[model samples]
Target: MSDWKLFTDAACTEEFGGTLTTVHKTNFSDNPQDFVLYFANVAGDPGDNQVLELVEATQPGTNYLTMSIVDANVGSGHEADEITLATTAAGLDTAIAGASLDLGQDDDSIGVIRLLSGVSAAQEIHVRVENAVPNEGTSTELSSAMVEAISRTKSTA
Candidate 1:
């Protein structure tokens, strides 16, 4: 729908990341396999905001470098502004679709993104959005958004 920005605080204020908002984290713990993230859209047509991919920054592409997106949700709640999102994204028996998520809303988790296993070592993973055009030219990498320095201990059991 529109370009987005990143924020450290839950209120969505104090914008961090780059001008277009980049989510970069170094030394990411591997204990929590399920990682949570929020979403919001700006007022410009950037690209198709359909799916998200996890790849190593060193190997920037859909190569299954280090991480994986187990699952995702539209969002439980969102904010109209950079304030507290007092309202929930769903009401009654409405089904929330991740494909048609409201990018206009404030940062809110999609849902249940789990990782199979940690990387081989301390590696940087780049989380980027893509336009799923189904073998069409419409597909493209949406943003330079990324997360880096993810670390975890490989169990030797």
Candidate 2:
């Protein structure tokens, strides 16, 4: 099995909490691969709460990627979060395993590592962050560890 690693890490600013936006993209070779979504950072109003969503790019007229948290079953309405592993064929919404991320006084940031199944030198990957709930949220760019780790694994394989 190809082992995936961390390539990038990102932290969203206060300005990003307003709308959904693309944080960063990893330029990979044109190859089919699987991706694991990791929670790098998280922060919100402790009292009110919020949820963050990670989704895959949709391909018009296709049912893919489900909008659901992995660890926390709470809808995008409270202070909870989740993670999942996704693939180009499957998508982000559909994940195998994930977990909820809670923000503490100092635990305002989370980092996730994705493992690529089969990536070539032509295909690329990107991550999108959406403030599902309303409170306050931010994330760092995909960590270098996360990005480099993935490619390195491919080389060894």
Candidate 3:
């Protein structure tokens, strides 16, 4: 079905099916408040020009995320490729800025900007096309597993 997929980091190696991204808001602001999200068409494929939406899989309260996709690109070569997000508070504010990710580059990549404590990992997130869900919600989840198959992993180490 949909070739697009989601990952926890820019490298796009770790999937979000069973992982947790640390919450980083006001009071619970983690060190690197700016979480990076790179959700593209597929692995190393880059450049499909997609508009992805991420919602708490089950719609929880504690994990409700205010974070959004601040920046994205071919996801291959950039100064911020693997750099830790938000060395400073100002940077974090910039990372989690929007609600949707636009992949107009038409390249292969994967990543995300999510809430940690405010956004609970206990619930499942449904990644789908913009206003075009077939199986779940308004659109179908962006994965190949017939069932929803997204991913996550915020380990700095």
- Name the best candidate (by TM-score): 3
> Per-residue lDDT of 40-157 in model 1, one digit per residue for the tens?
2222213333233222344333122221222222231211111111113322114222222211111125322212221111112212222221222221122222243222221122
Model 3 per-residue lDDT tens digits across residues 1-157: 1334445654555665632233333332233323344443343233322233322344322122322222234332221222222223344344332233222211122333332111111122232212111222221112122122223322121
User: Which model scores highest in lDDT?
Assistant: 3
* lDDT, each prediction: 0.25, 0.26, 0.30
Model 2: lDDT to the true structure: 0.26
Clash pairs, candidate 1, are 38-108, 39-108, 41-103, 73-110, 73-111
Error of 1 at 138 (Å): 31
Tens-place lDDT digits, model 2, residues 28-99: 232222332333223221221222222122321112222233223334332222223233334545433342
lDDT of 3 at 50: 25
Error of 2 at 25 (Å): 23
What's the distance in Å from true for residue 71, model 1? 17
Q: How far is 99's C-alpha from truth in model 3 (Å)?
A: 4.0
